[model samples]
Target: MYTISDYLLDLLNYLNVKDVLGVPGDYNLSFLDHITRRSDMKWRGNMNELNAAYMADGYARQNGMAVLVTTFGVGELSAVNGLSGSQAEKVPVLEIVGTPTLAAQYDQKLIHHSLGDGNFEHFQNVHKELGFKVEAITKDDAISEINQVVKYVYENKQPGYLALPVDLTEMPVNPIFKQLIPSLFRNKNEPHDHLQNIEAISNQLKNSHHPILIIGEDVQRFHLQDVVRNFIINNDIPFADMIESKGIIDETLPQFIGTYNGSLSKDLTNQLINKSDLILLLGAILTDANTGGFTQSFNSQNTIDINAKRINFYSKIINYNEQNGFVNLIKIISQTSLSQSFPKGPHDSINNKLPVPSDKPITQDFYTSAMSNFIQSDDTVIAEQGTSLFALEQIKFPANVKFICQPLWSSIGFSFPATLGSQLANPKRRNVLSIGEGSLLMTIQEMGFAVKYDLKPIIFVIDNHGYSVERVIHGMHEPYNDVPALNYSLIPEAFGAKKNQYNYFDVRTEKELLMAMKSIENNSSQLSIVRVSMAASDAPEDLKEFGKIIAKQNKG
Candidate 1:
């Protein structure tokens, strides 16, 4: 007989979820068994629940939607931070939590993973606070609830939580439920005022002399990059991308000016955006990091903000019922005669010239320039927050390269496990992970999972002593900023990687770092870790300024 577990897995399979990611807990074992029995879905176990959640977040960023399974209470709580990050970034991840039997929960029986108080709903409530559409699945409502929750997560691009009782996995389900649910795509019915709003926007674009288009993370989340690119090319409109949405469109396009980070943006980019008579913000969230600590200053009177559910034309708001409303609106706008001429010529792209190697110790500026030269087209770069992210901001990515980071959540250790999940999502692309030493220490065990799967990702461990970002903010010489040094060269072997499976390098000077990068380029098939040592005091200039702003804000 088909079980609820089977039905759920089948539905997820319809959404292109080929691999299920989680850590096995006692409560989740049976569900995991069901996952393993299916040929369409493979179970990829992680080192811990938090890492699993992070992996799911990364997988969702690449794979449209992701499913993460964890046990009730302890396991789910451990994964909460990662889920919060996904929620803040508007990523679609469905978290399935296996709880104690229905009978036990109803009787208030104290379970192993539950709080001693016997309240099973506490954890689900916590997820509710994090903005997940939560539900408790029962035999009567399992089919409908699963479909609703999954659809909500996918269409809204937000996290969803489902509590699955341990005994419910074995419950028999009707054969009729075995058929996949209908596709979640909604029928495109134009709103009544869509034509008027589209025409108004077109007129504004045509009348303006200086117009700028800014795309954000939501465009990538909603799979509208191609449509946005087409609009840019069709209109000959100059465009800038937010830091959070970097690499969503090809950066090499001459129409592409540069990344706009509020006041932190390049001088030319900032000047053009500030001077624009009309600004079109497509799916941009305008978060603190995206706006350079809330420094972006565009008048609503001169801006048209397009979001998933609604559109703000100048100061007026228009809501649409179609799920693909944003897509339709952009297409309609693109087809109209929006611009008679290009507003401005594109600024020159960054010069990614490779630095000459010398006997000098490697600095942040030199490292950023070298890395810019090292990154090729189609590589997926996972940059951890702090130094790694700041340095990556200076690099110019080639076409089709995907850049993944958690700037909104700003979680330190997220990129390591995320690298693994991103690689699993699209194994064809080369995954390069750049993480600081302090961040690596939090989720270093995930390296074992990488070795277990025999996945090859170039890992760069920046050994800048410790929490350099924090140091630059307030405590430059405080003991709290320091982290213990590790023998990074031996990490692979300790994580069960054979010599053939990986390569390890320890470099302090410019020549050694260059040699290690060259060697990894030559042998790109195996996993390689390069631990480059730098002075603890060295940091990117932008990071230092950002830290000052944060420090002032914190004091206030």
Candidate 2:
């Protein structure tokens, strides 16, 4: 009695998905029963579709891939922004959209979740436009379509869409298709001219005096951190990570330089990067944010850009069809004899000193420095796009710390929900969420989800009164940048967290902030929210400069 719903669940379960994230609607109610009944997978319903999608994105970042379920039309539309961010950041997320029944669609009936004009395909078309590998499933093609969509999303590391009709949930699948097999089409052979490209890259590395490796998010996505680290250590080459790829490799490594933003980078990092004779960009994408608004200056001829599908050495391009091309390249390069001597840049030793308790209010600089001291190794740190992210740029993370943020997408309200997913994916590690008041307000409902799941996360609500990121970009004094004031400390209790389950602190000064941190450390089993107040004009120096560049770009 294996049904279509069972087949999908089994496949996802085989992929190691322990939870399915979504917001239930009438169209998806029948399928939700299957998820609820399954002992291997639990249905984690979010307050809305957007947060569910964000949670899926975060889960995929930590757990390799994630599944997002939503109802058609309105529900799917609400999740589009989060899916787009996943697509932009190249995270693997499979979106299952429960649509109107096949009979209603065949008869062209106007449904509640469909367009008023009786067009059921409209929403599926929308997802396709956003680069999702979309397919509307029918009874006849359910198994094949499901497998195809999942395989595509898993292989490409991008979002995929499946429009599942409500009627198909209980349909019995053929006995022959009951045994779901892994994709047989995966090509494990080396790409064309793989050795040639590897040799060319090796020759370049061997001849160059000072070659630096610029690691990026793709390294983490492809699970090449160990091989990349081996290459770095074996060659004695200095390396720096981009914002999107921060903490992919251990930042505490002595050979690890600093974060390499274009002009906003530290003086030593900028100098070392600029002086390099050859730059090996392994799995690194040069997005505007990663390159400090595209201000990075390096000689094109001396750079070798290696990504998943293509290898660009100087201007000569070699396209590879295999997905493991990047993996193979790094592995072979790690084995090559290309040792080079380079001076290690001055590493920022982790400062463990707590701020001396004072009546003085905490400033942005003071808070950022303190946070650098507070974060421990192996903790997952999720920062919002605004002040939280900019402040994080100053901190040198401890070894094995997983840093999560939407730097490439620059979306506000993403971190809060993302923290929930990351924590659920790896419940053993402590999750720290640093978000501005403005960003948190957008997805504040997710706090209830965290409480309902009994997860313990230390949340820092940086209350600067309003949208400080927008103020620095433009309209420093404009009313449009202001957000409605809310008492953030009362949110956890309102979200159904009992007194014993959580702790809340309102800290305005350095002394108060330190006290709140100490209390949270003592009660590590309970959820803690520390709301720190700061001036609206105060921000990290890097953020102020980056904002001005963005403002200029927007004006043009």
Candidate 3:
């Protein structure tokens, strides 16, 4: 005789959710108590609802799935942005919002968070834009609704929304639910055209002369990295990933080449991908930001784009119902007689050689080189939007390193709180965050959450004095783009960091930056912060080109 909340927690446990990220509110306090009672699940409280959603996203990206709890109206609305981003990225997250009691909603009572019109269904419609599955749980259908939404999230790799009334939080549910949820585990809606699709793809590859594999965010979101890696290595195929899929494959692998970002890619990368006779795009999303503002020149007729449930060959759309999905397709293709060799990708013959350290001050070029050498294997890189996102793209990541950034959504303040969630998800791996001062200020309160949880992610704050990316876009010297310079090194103390618990460094020169890196190496336990100061107008080379494209697009 478990309560609905307990049943929900158990369902989440079956989905591998070890922790729930959320902020507390009066409506959700009852549900929070149940979260406290569950021995297998822990509640990670955040300072705000948006941060909670980002934390849940990071957790889901690492742990397969994540649940986030928030209150009705205000709380749920604040979390909508994060949930939408997860949907755009095709990550699986369950957003559970605690609402007023059933009676209050029935009577249409005016609530504190409502718009005074007594309409409670507005937010429900709003969240529908995020994913296909959404359920407003009731006393009668609590178990079934929770089960359905969770199953849909797992099957589809998209976020799900559930609004639980306060009255139903601890209400006991049917004992049959325990057995039902476990039984439904085997009932996922898998693709059903595995054999035929694999044969088709194999035949196509056999006919092609130059074939290349392009991976994207879907591979990571669907947890097919190992299978995809095996396929690439066994087939001896040259492969590349989109900007958002950094580190999906080990960059150190011989067949693994540089990232392909349409025109923004290196000359060699563009030449290899653009001139190829056949392109097998696996779960790749060709967004404007990742494709250099729609400058990609690949012919759709020659591309075989494979998504979760559908395959696109040229202009034809084939919906394949495959039970094993891309895994089986890859397995069959591995044994096929496709050519095992192709022209070397751009990774070789590319000069990533760093120039001599400039004596003047820290620049984006030097920073990228410093970071390339500083990052090690098993490190998760959390990159904030704007300059931090585009700048870090040039760095060479070590094996097993993950690069997390919101390039498509371009949401600021995401990486700051995301560090908290990713660290908690993978506690053994070191988390390194690169964020600008403007972006950091948006969710700086989450720094306290990191301190409270004893998370030691190395944070790099690029102190450019303002929104450098914005300046590049339109207002180069406009005062509207400028922001005040605040001392970032002292923020740890303000966030309640104990004496030995944290270390801070402010660097304006290459010498100072290297010294800070050495100090961080020596003091590994402390949460270290290294502030890199740079010119206000300067930005990464790719970022500069992107801004120009965006500015032109806006004008048109």
What is candidate 3's lDDT per residue for 1-556, written digit by digit as tens?
Answer: 5788888888888878888999888888999998888788888899999999888888887778988999999999999999888888887889899888889888999988888888888888889865548898987777778878998898778899999998888798776777777677674555455566678888888777788889888788767788878877877788887788989988778887678777888777788887788999888888888999999878787899887767787767877554556555554565675564677654732225655665669988788878877788999998988888887775657899998888887788888888888889888888889999988888899989988989998999999988888998999988988777777767888888887898889899987887888788777787989999999887989899999999999999
Q: Between candidates 2 and 3, which one is better according to lDDT?
A: 2
User: Which portions of model 3 show Cα errors greater than 4 Å?
Assistant: 187-191, 321-337, 346-358
lDDT of 1 by residue, 1-556 (tens): 8899988888888889998988888888999999999888889998899999899988888789999999888899999999999998888999999999989988999668878787888888898887899988997888888888988898889999988888999888887765546544545465644887888888888898989889888888888888888878887888888777888988888778888877777778888888888889988877777787888868787899997768888778889866667777877787766537765655544446676789999999878887888888999999999999888875657999898999889888999989999988888899988899999999999989899988899999999889998998999999999999999888889999998999889898999999999999999999999998899999988788888888989998
**Local lDDT at 336 for model 3:** 74
lDDT pick, better of 1 and 3: 1
**Candidate 2, after superposition: displacement of residue 182 in Å?**
4.6
Instruction: For candidate 2, give the lDDT of residue 20.
Output: 95
What is the TM-score of candidate 3?
A: 0.95
Local error of candidate 2 at residue 88 (angstroms)? 0.4
Return the TM-score for each candidate structure: 0.96, 0.97, 0.95
